[model samples]
Target chain A: MATMPASPAAPSSDERLARTGPATRIMRRPEFGAAIGAIVVFVLFALVDSTGKFASLDGIARWTDSAATIGIVAVAVALLMIGGEFDLSAGVMIGTTGLVLGLLVTEVGLGIWPAILLTFVFAAAVGAMNGWLVVKTRLPSFIVTLATFFSLQGINLGVTKLITGTVRVAGIDRGAGFDSARAVFATDLWEPYRFRIAVIWWIAFTVIATWLLTRTQFGNWIFAVGGDANAARNSGVPVHRTKIFLFMGTAMSAALVGIMTALRLRSVQAGQGVGQEFTFIIAAVVGGCLLTGGFGSAIGATVGASIIGMAFIGIAFAGWNTDWSFLFLGLILFMAVMVNTLISRRASAGATK
Target chain B: MTTLSEAPVPTGEKILELKDVSKSFGSVIALRDISLHVEAGSVTCVLGDNGAGKSTLIKTLSGVHEPSTGTYEVLRKPVRLSSPRDALALGIATVYQDLATVPLMSVWRNFFLGSEPTTGFGPLRRLDVKKAKQIARDELLRMGIDIRDVDQPVGTLSGGERQAVAIARAVYFGAKVLILDEPTSALGVKQSGVVLKYIVQAKERGVAVIFITHNPHHAYLVGDRFFLLNRGRMMENWTRDEVDLDSLVKAMAGGAELEALAHELESLGGAAASAAEEVADVVSHPTRGEDTR
Candidate 1:
């Protein structure tokens, strides 16, 4: 954190910065603080857990599995945020997509393969609607997605009860093509220690997202639109297209998590994934995403999710109530932000002189 | 619409000619009777005070806003631009007052931005990292901009360097007509000189540069043709041989100096004239003083 520049700096030091000065190099990365935070939290968990199992390979698998779902959504949320918008309906859309898939398989008697395809299209359409509404109305995405959040929440509950008379939908395993779907989405991997396929999905998503953000034309536009939209628009960037794609991407990622959950548990509740939007948002922010937008990384969100995972399982392993995880994450988030701010400020101040 | 034209092949030609162009934002008029010609290999400056419709003229030319009236000729053919992209399609690029460069993004990324060079196809398509870096470096070098690294965030560059990078990018992307909005308005004296140097460099490379500024000194340093705008109208037009630094400054001041001179004369003469009258009248009116009272 001490290495990153805090403010915009003059061009002379830029020469030295190009040489990879430790301080200048670190300041360039928005996620440096988050990386450090993740490391600290991991070490603390390993050292303090009363059960030594927290340090084992199985423990790594346990925490990683917990982190995978949130990590997947958080990275996409981070990208959307970098493009300067929010998708508040993400958590609810998870429920919405999952329920739609569950019902199609259980009641509609559709194969998992077909059900999944329909579910994806459904989620994408809803996402496209959210993006379109945001661009057309020129409303703050917070307000826009909030409307979506409430709407989807109602639909998930109302339609589920209307069809099943119960909040939960089960018998997903009995549906045709369930085994293959599980193999793709919910299977366990590695011989001795079972790891969820979702973890592999999370890693792949992060890599692709990172490449898309940092190594593509679209990635450049993401930063431009987020930093200043009018300026970006004036520069010939298709600002609306960039934003809409981002919104759709976020929703689709959440839907992937929804599919994985239903396939693994063999059921999805009507209220599934409700009120969990904040977790994805918090994880992104903790991963070094700027709340104001235009600055963050996909890897950073992944690192942030690991912090949450560590706290969730570490508290349990240390013989403490798992509820302490929330308090622990909250404190870590505040500290990470403070550390990042202080370091960047100093780096910028030094550059001007 | 010459997207196929390559850089370093600039033709010494008339690129953009605007005649009596006018723009109104609903009820408020921003520009009227605006006429200017930007010639390739020359620096044409649009000079104005704050709110003097410089931005409107820029927007109109760069395709951000279409002129409500008059003919905007590109490459000797009149056309109405629907968007900045349209203007770019015709080889007209605008560098705005609030620069479009993303501060958190690397220099190379900001340079290639919308027209980024990429390889492969579809979802597998990725930016040509080496090519982009090389070009960014080469372009900056061409502009005489000494950037230490292409990967550094653009915000680290001083105001002047950033403007230089924007100019270099405009040139590298084959912009025949470059419109700069207050490029040196936010720069220091030396930094302003640096940007002025790049304006000349662009001109040497045969790019028609429109350098907009409120600073007469900066304009005089590089401008070959100057257009003075005020209150939505063209106040004055001067070629390089026709205008001097003093006249340019005086015009930009909008008669403030003349008004101040009149005020100074009124106070200086009134006190002296009144005092002389009192002494002369006292002597001349001594005999009639008792009667006058």
Candidate 2:
């Protein structure tokens, strides 16, 4: 038998490694570009604000309120993207779930809490259906969820108009347990500034999603399935199950935002969340999620949402045409992705050297 | 450290045996009348060119495909395998050329990809990141892989280092019989040497290694016993003492086929034919250092 090396040899010439410094290491993270982008956008808006309130605590509350709803769903969409799937149905799922909540409370005469519970069950069923179809049919999730998007869009308008004789549902404030439900989902916290409770929910979801991605077995599976599905399956990872659950997660988070929006407005519109799916995807991509899959961060998605939120409020405060906002967002996406790609290339190259 | 078994199993114990194996896909025969045995602390090299039934043999051994007629045995007891997982459960692990690793993932994460260890209770449980990283670093070091950082992505590693990672992973996961498919085919001269070193390291640790390669030089360097496969048949089987490098190369190249090619070239050309004849002579009478590259 061969003896163990008598002592750990000095760093050999053949495998001499050049370890990274703190700055390079930090820049190597998948979310670093998004983090930097968030700061730059904040500073640029702060410099150009015409309405002095745009830089105040009240403005912070207003912009974060806009970001929170998008951030909530964006976090889950980020997870689904990392697991290598897309849910085009996420945006329409909001309208569908809100209509369900509004109908259950106003027409079915159920308590606000029970109606909310039934809405979640409905959302889960749709999510599960999206997941099952993607796994069993082996079709691209983009195609399957796109079909779901169109179907749900039709159902949102058709079912709401058929029952309520209008394109919207109202009188949610008169339903049983309205006071308690509003306190949980729609209440404004803190005096003077009156920050919305949804911001806290958004922050909490971000924390949980980050923990799930970084510190859990499920998180590892997400990265694995996204990185290389064949390698993962050969290594005994449950590829299909992980992917299905990611689809379900995106659907369910959309439902949460739907319920919150319905509660805050005390009404639901058929087209309330229509066309918002692209917004969630934009937030995720700007946050450094790869369209191809396997590499991203949840906090990055949150940062991306905040950047959008700032742009929306900042543009209005600067008295610029709101139409220019989309152009600015497109530019932001391109720049964030470019910086992320370059930094990642350098990080990997430096590590090997 | 917790899973490392320092005491090697006694040598010369036959760990795996395939008896009278023949596999046919529909009407086409892929492998016919094949038999081989692997022992503890030894390397069995299976040498074949492309489409020489090497993949079929590997599949049959690793349970990706079942032999049409054979008794596959492990530890002298016949066992039927239905899937790759079944083979893995029985301590038979196959590392393909790609090495079954996600390149973008960190080394520690890829090391514990499928079977991650978690610590804590109920919903509060989490991946034991510190333990996984430590064990991954230690196990790789034990295999002489000496990776400085377990956090580096697997893509940053060289081809040979990735092979070492895969080998080390299989060993740490309690593989008794490791099947390596062309581990050196994509590597350079130095990288091939590195992978060959790890194969020897694995053999010395008492793991039965079945190395499948197309290169005779690589096979002859570390192989204890050699099996030559040609056209879905076992043409020759010899122990290290019974064969030398030149004969091994000659058998693999089919000496008659080379001679015929040399003759064919002579009739077709003048300068090129002379060059071809000279090349054939060097191949037929290979010098030790001259042919290794």
Top lDDT hit: 2
Weakest ten-residue segment in model 2 chain A by summed lDDT: A1-10
| Global Cα lDDT for candidate 2 | 0.87
State the iRMSD of every prediction, in order shown: 10.7, 4.5
Per-residue alpha-carbon lDDT of candidate 1 for residues A1-353, written as tens digits (9 for 90 to 100): 01112322343444456355777677757788888888888889898989898879989999999899999999999999999999899999888889989999998899999999999888888888899999999999999999999999998889889888998888899999999999999999996789889999999999999999988889989998998787677677899999999998989999999999999999999898987788888788888888888889999899888888888988999899887878887797788878777766666554432
Poorest 10 consecutive residues by lDDT, candidate 1 chain A: A1-10
Best by TM-score: 2
Tens-digit per-residue lDDT, A147-225, candidate 2: 9999999988999999999999999998889999999999999989999999999999999999999999999999999
Cα displacement (Å) at residue A126, model 1: 1.5
